[model samples]
Target: MWLLETTTLKPQLFLGDSTPYYAILSHTWGSHDKLQNLAGYVKIIRCCAEAASCGFKYAWVDACCIDKTNSAELSERATECYVYLVDATDPSGFGNNRWFTRGWTLQELLAPCSVIFFDSDWNEIGTKASQAEFICHNYVAQRMSWATRRETAREEDLAYCLLGIFDISMPMVYGEGRKAFRQLQLEIMKESTDQSLFAFSYRLNIGIRPIVCHLLAESPSLFRECGTIQAPGDGPAPEYSTTNKGLRIELPLAHCIGGFYSAFLNLTRKVCNIREL
Candidate 1:
């Protein structure tokens, strides 16, 4: 493990079976370019100071601890790091903070068994364990909201950064564009039994929402009887497919007032007007 020296801000590597206590830093990088040099050390310093005050001898700041130049190392660290502190505070307060909207931060929020939120001034706010009920209740919806709006420098990272949250691993293919997200989702379906993974973007027909329902309905037979099932015997499995042949419905044209018809089609193709009141 490599840690940043709290005072000197230098890198220190440790190796052994004895686990040395360390604090991990989690914050949204406002600009990717800012993280390329020591000028971005402000967050690292604050995290180190906060960790030291908490009796932690070392800390891990993602911006500095991981060598972004090395893709394999970066992916490895992202997959392995599970304990972290989220810097959620802003001048406007936690609700308006960028940390909650960044693509990479999703895993930072979900994977950590122990997560502490800190204010802009490095003051303690709350812990994930304390907010378990609220998080669990809104997990799927909140995650969907996060994934939809979060930004990433590399488009593929929107899905790559979520690898930890879904407990899926894949080779990092940087330039795959939206296909990376599709691959990520397929991996999630293969490993997970959660149907909610398909419940995304119901409000936008052009997005992943429309395709996910078909994906879920056509998932391997293993997902048919229950939420989960064992892989079939060593032979060719059944194939699944779908098509967009379009839908039609009959309704009173008089009821389509105030442009409701236009908005309805934009939302979903499966739903159409019916004559029955």
Candidate 2:
């Protein structure tokens, strides 16, 4: 593991299992800032100071810890860093923090055994365990909600950044555009039985109004197939494919109508009433 030397901000290598406790900075990277420059160094310095305050001698900041010019090093570091201190605090508090909306931040939020949230001013807000109820109920939906809204400098990064979330790894292929996201979904489906992975927007019409609705109604178990496959050692990889046609399901008209009503009713209670809509 490469750690930032707290004093000189130099990269130092340490054995993965033998490393000392360290703090990680998880924040959105601005398009214009160069990590070697003064503006970019500010966040790194602040994070290092924060780690020192917490009795940690080492810190890891993605901007400085990984050598972006070396693709191999970048890939290695991406999965190595797990614990994260997500900056989720804004003037409006944790609810409105932009970190929650990021595609890469989704993995940062879930994969870690523990995650601490800090506000814009670097004040302690809470931990992921403390916010269990909110995260459990809304985690997947929250990811879907902002998956389209978050921005990445490289389009392929939209999917590459999420490799750790599904515990899957692949070589970075730049210039794939939106195809990267499709490949990501295929990889996820091979390893996971979570139907919520397919809980993305789809077209539905109630009366004369066409509306966007989430497949499986944000339920992870609804569409999950009940079975398991035992692969032989050195067997072939699982077969999966993606098509331009959106995810489709075949069901009786009554069942489809009932699901729509149930989803609509659930939305009404949480967000708006039919009259308000």
Query: How many clashes would you count in candidate 2?
Result: 1
TM-score of each predicted structure versus truth: 0.60, 0.60
Candidate 1 overall lDDT versus native = 0.53
lDDT of 1 by residue, 1-277 (tens): 5677766778887655433667778765544537665545666777777777777777788766776666654433321222222344443354445666567776676665677777655666766775565353222223443455566778788778877656678878878887787777667656543334444433335532222234332211111212211222433323322225532222224333443332111111122221100
Cα lDDT, all candidates: 0.53, 0.53
What is candidate 2's lDDT per residue for 121-147, written digit by digit as tens? 566676767666544322233333434
How many Å off is the CA of 67 in candidate 2? 2.0
Local lDDT at 187 for model 2: 68
Model 2 regions lying over 4 Å from their true place: 15-21, 30-39, 69-93, 137-148, 204-277
